[model samples]
Target: MEHRIATFLSRLSRTWLAAAVLAAVAIASATPAPAQDFITVASTTSTEQSGLFKHLLPEFKKATGIEARVVAVGTGQALDMGRKGDADVVFVHDKVAEEKFLAEGFGVKRLEVMYNDFIIVGPKNDPAGAKGKDVVEALKKIAGTSTPFTSRADKSGTHAAELRYWKLAGFDPPKGAWYRETGSGMGPTLNTASGMNAYALTDRGTWLSFKNRGELVILVEGDTKLFNQYGVMLVNPAKHPHVKKDSGQKFVDWVVSPAGQAAIAAYKIDGEQLFFPNAKP
Candidate 1:
């Protein structure tokens, strides 16, 4: 009886140990794993609207195993987000603003990423007679005729370029019905112009990818002033200690790298390339 009792005790001990191990395993299996590596990038609406991020970020993730999450806004807002330490990196156009951001110590440095030109898109009827004309002359005509012009007015790179053209044209567009401000992004502004049969300035990439173009057509292009250059930079870790510096720098380096440039060059719509890779080695 004593031997039988000892045997039964040993079996019970073994069973208890096994049950404890199984319970631990079940608890671990039920628990969630930590998040994967990721970095936040504040970029322009044109990049998002053109679907460049969708095409580019996946490849970046596949290559480096680091996910890039983008917040698409105007260049000004993107820089603002960097200033507030809400972003790990920034990618935007508008060289003047980018330079100012670097000078203000918001970013480590600016690296040119790509380039595209802006074009004047207008109604097919060409009421303002802007087609094939010089861009400044086209703006002047649009302003002079008070032809319905849709402005992004969102402090975007495209809006900045439009303001520069207006200044060069020697006039300030007043608040009126003919000159409408969308206070929105590039894609919506283009859509509004299309819907209203008005004129708007848009980057070539967004213009190419935009499918809602109602009666609008490219009216003016090929001006040297219309050149749009995009830049990338890591947010200053000194200002934002919480920033993912390593991940952000990796993203910047990858974007300017040869493989990244090739990837950017590879993205196309309907057999036409969008952004041209102009990053220097």
Candidate 2:
């Protein structure tokens, strides 16, 4: 009887050990791995709307095995995200704001990534008679004639550029039915302008990718002031210790690299290049 009891006790111990081992294994398997291989990038809606991130990020991941999750907002919002340490990197088009970010120690450095000019899009009928005119003069006509111009008053890089043009044109656009502010992104603002049969200033890239153009055409372009430049920078790790510095820097380096530049140069809509890669690395 004693020998049988001892044997039973040994078997029970083995069973308990096996159960403990299985529980440990289950816990280990259920635990998630660290997500250090991915980084968050705050960028402009123009990049997202133009479909550049879709084309560029895949190649970046394939080459580096690091995933870049993009948060598409306006340039101002993007920079603000960097300032608040909400983003690992910033890719935006507003040079003044980008410079300000760098100067304020929010970003490590600003590197020019690409460029696309802004164009005045209007109805084919050209009610404002802005077609084939200088952009400033076009705004003046739109304001003077009160011909239903849609302004992206969302404080985006495009919006900043538009305000600059208005300042140069020497008139604060009258706040009324004629000057409509669509506190939205480029694509939506363009769609609003299209639906209203109004005029809007838009980046050429978004204009090219837009499909709901409905009688809208590029009314004004080729002016030097319409030139738009995009920049990229890693959020300062010194400011935000939680920032994924290595992964963010890798993405920044990859974008300005030859392969990345090639990818940017390769993306086109209907065989027309949208963004020109002019990264001065």
Candidate 3:
């Protein structure tokens, strides 16, 4: 009788163990799935700081159900991030740099996303006498004088354009006590320019978004050379072997899509458009 009772108890324990395991499995199966479908995009500060991403990304998320996590830096840094496989996509404003990145096999392809021109901002008084529609000529005047000019010398797209304008104006990357190179993003560099009342070259989007004007005002604009073209590219998955290619390409495809272009065109500050979507259909 004792042996029989021992066997019965052992069977009961096994039944309970099986029931517990089944219950645990059921609970796990009923649990919600992880919603971590996202891609990292290395983009420029102009897109982020100018509130373009704030307005644009949500629309993208709604359409694709994939989140775009942006690392907003200068265009150069963004490209570098793509090169290092630190990001799944690169969205930046330098066509030359973007082409170089593609040529070097870091990016799969480059597509034009949008375009916004750059403007020269300076003190309201225009101390450098740089106020004009001619960007190159305005830069020339600023350099000719010992006018304090602030440069975002972080090798950014804006900085590259600034240097190009200088070179076009027949100056060799002007450097002196009058020139200040702040190795910083667009917003901070603009802040510095405001603080110093120094001349600065900035994208129209950022210039519009910036509120701490102090004495700064748009001094020069409407020059063809100041045209800033933004491009998007996917990081080469074959090169990285770990890149989220499907999601990244989805974003690239969406950004140039009709819906994306409409969304970009709809984003405005005080009804003033920020970025004009120029994505070719």
The residue-level lDDT of candidate 2 at 206 comes to: 94
lDDT of predicted model 3:
0.92
- Candidate 3 structure quality by residue, lDDT tens digits, 4-64: 9999999999999999999999999999999789999999999999999998899999999
Local accuracy by lDDT, each model: 0.94, 0.93, 0.92
What CA RMSD would you report for each candidate? 2.0, 1.2, 2.7
lDDT tens digits, residue span 184-273, model 1: 999999989999999999999999999999999999999898899999999999999999999899999999999899999999999999
What are the per-residue Cα lDDT tens digits for candidate 2 across 90-204?
9999999999999999999899999999999999999879887598888888888889989889889999999999988876645667888989999999999999999999999
Better of 1 and 2 by TM-score: 2
Winner by lDDT between candidate 2 and candidate 1? 1
Candidate number achieving the greatest lDDT relative to the actual structure: 1
Candidate order by lDDT, decreasing, is 1, 2, 3
What shift in Å separates residue 233 of candidate 1 from its native position after superposition?
A: 0.2
TM-score of 3: 0.92
| Candidate 2: residue 247 lDDT (0-100) | 90
- Give me the runs in candidate 3 sitting further than 4 Å from their true place: 1-35
Q: Backbone clashes in each candidate structure, one number apiece?
A: 0, 0, 0
Residue 245, candidate 2: Cα error in Å is 1.2
